[model samples]
Target chain A: MLAGGHGNSNPNTNYLKSRGLWVAYSIGMLVLHLILLSIPPLSIPMAWTLTNQVHNAITFIVLHILKGVPWIPTDQGATSLLTHWEQIDEGRQFTKTRKFLTASPVLLFFLTCFYTVYEPHHFVANFLSVCLVTLPKLPLFHKVRLFGINKY
Target chain B: MDILEPMYTLVFTELVPSFHVHLQVLLGLLVLWVLFKKSEKPGRPGKAGKSELDIINDWKPEPLVTPVPAKHRGLNAPVTKNQIAQHITVNGVKCLNFATNNYLALVNQQEIDDVAVAAIRKYGVGSCGPRGFFGTVDVHLELEEKLAQFMRTEAAVVYSYGFSTIASAIPAYAKRGDICFVDEAVNFSIQQGLVASRSHIKYFKHNDMMHLEQLLSEQAVLDRKNPKKAAKTRKFLIVEGLYNKTGEMCPLPEIVDLKNRHKVRLFIDESISFGTLGDTGRGITEYYNIPIEEIDLVMSSMEGSLGSIGGFCVGTTFVVEHQVLSGLGYCFSASLPPLLTVGATAALNLMDGNPDLVKELNEKCDQLHRLLHKSETLARYFRISGCRLSPVKHLFPLELKSGTENELQKIVDLCLQDGVALAVPAFQLNDVKFQTPSIRLTVNSKLEAQDMSKCLSTLEKTVIATFKPTSTS
Candidate 1:
């Protein structure tokens, strides 16, 4: 199977199921917050907001926008039309990885709210960002694309 | 900054019960992290005592056996819904099938079907065991005798599967420390055989005689240096009759000449050519009018022309008899079903009776070649390939910049809509780094000139419509 280089399919799902993935993700979130806090002008609240927002934006692009595994041709364009989120666990929901992924953003949002003291502006930004990451993970709108954006 | 005292009080009081799942999740994550660290502890670089554990951890097992195709994928490509024929139903739509390797157009033959039915009643659908066991049905012997008689060889052995015929036949003779000279464009079956043989392989450019000669000469120089070892080592020259990758026919006479000069065993895989080439459908040897005895080994699959399930190898009794024990698939795997064996025997009987069918197939191939190559209409769009009378034809798009773009697939899809089924298979043939994917169309004796014309016109319309005329033109 390695005749075609790098035979791994859905590398994202593989990493998600891996033991240290959530720990690494939490550490990454902490690292992002620390980097933002190190800025001279930023307060802890501002850093928390920025960290959640940055994390959400990256996740939105990666899990939602990116479609198909580029390394192997095994699936024969089966994953071409599917986003990474839709491709996860072959579209099965409520699996451990999906639950963890769903829980992660919500946990980050809770932390952001606590750090920002539930400020209206910070709450809105974190709420929208968390919604962006987690709503697509819902089974209701699993493969539904609104308004044909990135539909191709 | 303020310490957010209200948030701490809120978490301790109001949200404590509500965050039940979260507490368990955090605890689970921490435990998982600790477990992950412990699992990785053996791999620390400074440890000298744990080399054995490191080796076990690092080892990634390669697949040693072929993964049984997941209850799908027939012997060849192009999964069909109904009985395979010139016209096939794919995804509920019947289209003129130019995809399958059914070259002799032996489909829906009442006689062949009758034989299969009769045999099934007598011997059941399966032989149930390998050839040495109860697998050796009466019809299996009959088919082997028929094949040997047809090929004018002293003996023949039938393989339960088409691909296994070549894969097993090669290693039965050529073993480790032996050498194989193979053509570059040979299909995956031949490649599998070469790999299984564990023989030193030297691949020459596809059908390049000079390169083959040069390799032979280089081996000769090595032989001069070590005559004792050279005398013990057997040499094999392997080539496909009509290559599966490209439809290009190997120059058999020249190849035979080379085999004689080099004193190498000439093994020709006539899988696609048998029962499709020559006036009498006797295969590549007959096409060139060369005696069948000249080739040390001839392997032909019954799936293509004979319209059956298995494959067979023809040679002297001494050579083929070795495969009964040495050929892995022959001894280990269940033999071909009695009905399929009877089916192949009937198909051969029909071929022996009807020489006109083979002639008709060649004529159809010629007409296709003429339409695609003689007329300059498709020249801008494609580079026509294969020998003049080759049953298989390829249309490699000259205009397409990259194979990944798959303009050919779009054209195939559009043609399929117009009732013309074509294949641009992600062929498990040849390496992909430099090879351009082409539309593989197999010509059958059953297709009339008008039907083929309609197929080509649909293809032309689709090609023009899919890509810019100027770009393709």
Candidate 2:
């Protein structure tokens, strides 16, 4: 009975794990974008190093940690955890809408920062004030299913 | 400082810090991953077989077949031609059968028809399975027994078709380490067998004995080290008895004598020569009076001249038995239908009965060759004589001027339009095409003397019309 049940469970777990890896990669990119925006202006080069270059360097180690940490919720059943994690279509739509709405504001913020550095203008100050006001309306990104710290 | 040290320092300084970090870390990880993967799946006991993933990666979809030109569109489309006696009616008008391989005029012969009908009645329609199981009919066994007697060998085996006999026989003998020495101009069927068997193979120049000797010498050295692994190694000399392209006999007596002296076994594919050479048409072995006993193996397609649909091989009992046991083409495939065997059996009997018919065929070939040689239009392209046509029967080569086979085909097509059947592009192969001097006009016993004359006259006219001398501008 143990052998038969284990045989049945093995393929399902393997398939779920493979798909989970893709999700983790996408979430990692999102986290990198968020951290870049949150960083100080003068440290932009340092932030670039931390996000893209540093992340790339330690990605293998992170992936190993992600795979080892079991994602299934201890309190909830395995089915509930699988269902939450497998909601890819819903997550993609949310990400798409969030990106479209935030695009102009993100672009304006970067442009204003650059111009302030190159050619100082009141337009840069005005843009920063407008960005701060609009921050309240920014859609909150909620992690629906947390596997582990490295994966989340 | 060393010159190499300065170069290395310059390369190291130029690389970006991020790139250097990524390269060192990622390269190590990638190497480790590959090593882990290799360790998990140790390769095959022998060499690694081609994987499905490899096949998929290498897959190249075939390019589409080119569409026919608007003018030539009807060439590929089927036409329901009303075939008549001595004339093929196409588009409701009478034309000749230039593409037909009805050499002996045996297709509709009363004697042949009667024999075929009787055999079909006696032995149902088909044996319906392979010879190993229920496919072997009494007639099939009898045919093989008779073929062995005819070819004058110890034993014989019949195959469902001409190509399968060739495709089966070569591989049945050749294994992993065997080296097959083949003629460059060999039929595609033999080539397929050699390739599918995965044996080491080499090619000699077309009809070049010296080139063959050189290849054999090269093989002898390779064989010495491995000794070709007794189970895997055999050196086979494969060539045709009568080259279907030239319609000329192989220098078999010479080939056989040379191969024997060099300790290599020879297998002669006498598809074209059988039923058209020798006193009784046993084939090239007898045509040259080289004892069949001296030749290692003989294979024949009973299609072109024999008016049948299958192939047969004659050799020692051991070889014949071995082929029956392991020849995948024979073992996996269904056996030849009994009706075709009936027809072949009839053809063999008829060939045995009619000695004079063979003599008449020789005479007809002689007459046709002489007439074609005399024709001013054909004389330039066709270099043939009486001896080449046949000593005992009608078969000769039409050696064309280089790259004129298509032009010869056009003339043949014109002959067809004028109600005379002609054979022009007889054998087509890679880098080689055989254009007969005149169409292979067989003077079968069935055709009246008048009919023969009319055919010759029509041929002469077609030649004249097709190749009118290019006037000097």
Candidate 3:
């Protein structure tokens, strides 16, 4: 029920590990950036920064903060203790989805850096957001909760 | 100090007030309406309706299921290409099946088949409707009567599917707001019942009486706190007579004592134990020498030891009668085919007429247990877990690894090649999954005594070959 359980959360979502997921994720990120860009007040750099922050915030909550599932989890409480990150790839380290999730945030960070430049504010915010999301995804933090937070 | 005071006044008066532009507009509109158009009706023309429509459009329904990844369970899984096998023969292989719960070796009986075929020809293939409707065939009544007589109960209700019998019966009596203390390791069917009942389910640690007692005492405290509401909440203690998951027997005598002390009605799912336990094959009560009348309700699937399809629940006339009209599986779902009911009766009769069949099964269980426990090499890698003289047994891997199932599958496949079908998950699992695996072994009375030893030696050799113990000191 904890870190040691299997299946890809659902049979229909078997595409989570498919190669097209990377494409879909990139497209979603691009669409998010474009939507932010459409805001009249936001500059190109600000839009990229906002996109990075929004992406990281969502991934942080979904992949790490929310333990267990929110819907009718057919597998009973088998995933009661696992976050979506831990649930994916059945808790095996260095799997495809884990690598993609870790890499996506860093990629967004670099993309934001390229657009925002080293202006202290945007650079720092994007860097921090990427770090918040990507750090927990490192193999070092597989099941670790540093200050006894959310262990249950 | 002067500059800060002025800044605070400026921000509060100017900046904060400007943030509420919509509020200002609404207030101005209200004043204008009050002054210039006092008699106008107050309902907004279209704004609220438009926003409501936007909100309705924005609402997204959640996916029907959230895939919570569950793992492989180690049961006596008869391996085919992948699907679970039937009791008679697994995946077209005529092997000594020590996988399914064919305890009395009644599955292969000619008499049962003869009765089943004759009845099938007479009644045709299906009952064609739910039991409550026109599906109550004459054989259905006969089988129910036979089951009641066999169990020494006042009456019984037969369900179309064995899995749903208890699943449906449980919800019939134990509805929302009821309290049920359940064993955590009871099979999926009982778990389904617990979930469907929407009851306050307190799961005691599997087969731990102290844990159950602690839960009961906690409930007592609650009941003491709210005696009025407590009186309305029915409390049930549910346990399996023989747990199919662990191949272990419940401490029935202790459970009975606890239930009595806690003022809880007891429900036992004897799916795996009904025909295998007692000398006379009357299940856990008979085996423990407890009177059948002492138990409030009894649920069992005939799929296992009865060597037939469907399931039954037996108790006093009052308890059993309630299920006939209210049990979801019995009332709404189609009844068991007449032929299956007929065949089950024949199988039960065979068990009733010859008690030796059950006695032999008990002996086989003991033999298997003793062999596994005493096997020096087998002991290191796997510790046997299950009740002695209970036909269901488990070999839990001492050091569970990622490849544990594969290793066990290899042993099972090897055994199958040697004409003994041992059950393990030759499970074709995806790349990302983990679960503790064990080898489940079932003992049948039909297995040859010499073949038992031969199977044991084969298991040892295969296990020894499959797993090269690293720390072989």
Highest-DockQ candidate:
1
CA deviation > 4 Å runs, candidate 1: A1-152, B1-80, B403-405, B429-434, B469-473
Task: Give lDDT: candidate 3, residue B393.
Answer: 85
CAPRI grade, predicted model 2: incorrect
Badly placed stretches (over 4 Å) of model 2 are A1-152, B1-99, B118-124, B221-232, B382-387, B390-406, B424-453, B469-473
Instruction: Return whichever of 1 and 2 wins on lDDT.
Output: 1
Per-model interface RMSD values are 18.4, 23.8, 25.2
Report chain A TM-scores, every model. 0.89, 0.28, 0.86
TM-score computed on alpha carbons, candidate 3? 0.63
lDDT of 1 by residue, B1-473 (tens): 24667767756666444544354366446434433431222234566576787878988999997676663223434456978687888767789989888888776899889989998888888889999877898788999999999989999999999999888888777766789999988878778878777779889999999999999999999998878668768899999999877899999999999899989999999998999888899999999999988999899888899988889999999988878876778977999999889889999999999999899999999999888776454676788888888988888777667543357777787787788998885655444322667888889889899988988888878877876654557
DockQ for every prediction shown:
0.02, 0.01, 0.01
Q: What is the C-alpha RMSD of each candidate to the true structure, in Å?
A: 22.9, 21.2, 20.0
- For residue B25, model 3's alpha carbon misses the true position, in angstroms, by 35
Clashing pairs in 3: A9-B67
Clashes of 2: 1
Q: Please give, for residues B321-369, the per-residue lDDT of candidate 3 as tens digits.
A: 9777567788778889998999999998888899988888888888888
Over B1-473, each residue of candidate 2 has an lDDT whose tens digit, in order, gives 57357445544665323443343354345333433332223344444688868867888888687666764424743243643234556445465443444445556666766766786688767777888888888888888888887677899988988988887888777655567888875666777777766677888877888888888877667667654243245678889876654455567766887788667779889776776677677777777888887777788788766777889889999878777766766776788888788788878877878766555555555565565556664455455433444422222324445545556666666666666655543342342322243345433434455555666677667666655563222
Minimum summed lDDT over a 10-residue window in model 2 chain B is located at B389-398
